[model samples]
Target: MTNHTILEPLREDQWFIQSQELRSFLAKVSEISAHTVDDRTQTLARLEPYFQELLVQQEWLPQKFAQVNPESRMGGGIGQWLLYRAKNQSLSIFSLVIPPGSTTPVHDHLAWGLIGLYKGNQEETVYRRVDNGDAQGHAQLQITEVRRLKTGDIYRLLPPDGDIHAVKTTSQSASVSIHILGNDTGCIWRHQFMPESHSVKSFRSGYSNAPCEEEEEKEHALH
Candidate 1:
């Protein structure tokens, strides 16, 4: 579904955080065929109840996430890692950890996305693409809604609901969440919007941690 080299696996260096519950979730994700966007949406919905259990278990997270500094200018002032992606056009799962005061630039996901907050707090604003006035070929976005999410809050970003938004950590501690998206998001050509200039730019956010040996080889070949 994405335009980049596909990565397939359940874990890499991220294995240190795996649990039976997570493995079970992966098993369900594996059954998904990814034939259509709606099909994938329903698939993720089926696991919503189990995903709550994941929110309750906070010990499995890697320590590196807590150590991440919100002030770091690196990687959008946050930490992220790609835990898995289906070999074919199935799904991509990743984690985003944002420390207090960390925020991301306003952007849009070309594919469907679901975010489940497991720790701390966050505030997000959703935007509607009102115009594409960027002479340089970018989108113009308008804020549609703003919401604060706490642990176990699941936010949906499917079409028809204005999928563009900017996210920020509002808690004193680091906020961690599981982001499950359609296709390979890290390598896909998504939109990043500049509110001041009213411009948009294409961007691809690569994996923050590291992929497995097989995935690394495939990624190298793509380059």
Candidate 2:
């Protein structure tokens, strides 16, 4: 039961475009994170309000990044679009788009994060790992909570706590959520679980718009 796959850091910070809203939010996050390096809980607590503010401003996120990917890695037309990423790979922000009636695989983000509903509604089923994770590809998950999220609703992801979860778009339209995480979530090899089978597998849900490595950066437009 490995925690996550290790990967090299990006050579430089990547910003999809020059958006003042996102730039300011990133600045605030960096400031708060730098001061709260020793405590992840404090970091999330202090940043929630800022994250909330960002989520409510619907215009901040471009429509292009909010669209579902036909060739999605997460399948079922789920789109994970990267908005910004740090050079060190310690932080990232992205938008997750899940089409109507689609559910994400039960997954765990190794790093702490804040996720907020931006558009449409969703049903989130949160799980907890009861086993020690000593057996490879094996895991025992217990459902801890299930939530219905509306626009502006937010949740925290602090590992071993509110970490493992699956989200389904309950609304008629596709649901879009903003994710601010402590790691390169989409690029890193994280765990995706199958609760019915009590199994786990390593997967990398790469961004629909951005490539993982620096060499491929040229393929996408930069502004």
Candidate 3:
């Protein structure tokens, strides 16, 4: 089967912004202001459907993100595209296409995030921040859970909800997802992937071997 076959088929009309669930989710996310864990969780739950709807509408996403390139300052990979950026509200929507044997670095966002799988299968491993040192030193992070996501799956990441995770495509085919987040300006603090020294290393260490060894090696040397 082709990579597109991995995606759940949908009617053209379904892509319209008519679903009550989606509308409600957008309303909640758009209005969320409180930074408390409880409040964030509630807002994320309501916004999950928006992520789902975007993923379901992938048929038109490429054209919308035609101007995006993975090598640009935004930093993404082949088949990955950014659809829109609302820097003023600290929100951005991204459509990722993961080629077979490809993987994203283990990273964390500055704010909460929502992910909806539209195409193929992906494996997600989440981490939790932990206090490992005195107040004068930095705390450590730990891997807490691992999940395998396929088409039609939706998940949230934030303060209360799990947010720190690493993802990998399941096969040679592409896996697509819609990412909604609170920060779009690219000014937020991004957690760098410290694979060799991080507290959470085992969860994503062996899942998928790197496909571009030469490029990865060059990047590693630069780091």
lDDT order of candidates, best first?
2, 1, 3
lDDT of each: 0.68, 0.90, 0.54
Off by over 4 Å in 3: 1-38, 63-80, 87-89, 132-139, 185-187, 199-223
Each prediction's RMSD over C-alphas, in Å, is: 4.5, 3.1, 12.4
User: For residue 99, what is the lDDT in candidate 2?
Assistant: 97
Task: Quote the lDDT for 49 in model 1.
Answer: 66
- Worst window of 10 by summed lDDT in candidate 1: 7-16
Per-residue lDDT over 100-147 for candidate 1, one digit per residue giving the tens place of the 0 to 100 score: 887887877666667889888999988888764535665667788999
Regarding TM-score, does 2 or 3 come out ahead? Answer: 2
Candidate 3 per-residue lDDT over residues 170-204, each given as its tens digit: 85566777667665413333444454564332111
Angstrom error at residue 80, model 2: 0.4
Model 1 bad stretches (over 4 Å): 1-17, 32-41, 65-76, 132-135, 160-162, 211-223
Worst 10 residues of 2 by lDDT: 214-223
- TM-score top scorer: 2
Q: Give the TM-score of candidate 3.
A: 0.62
Clashing pairs in 3: 90-182, 100-172
Q: lDDT tens digits, residues 170-212, model 2?
A: 9999999999999999888889999999999988899998888
Model 2 alpha-carbon miss at residue 184, Å = 0.5
- How do the candidates rank by TM-score, highest first? 2, 1, 3
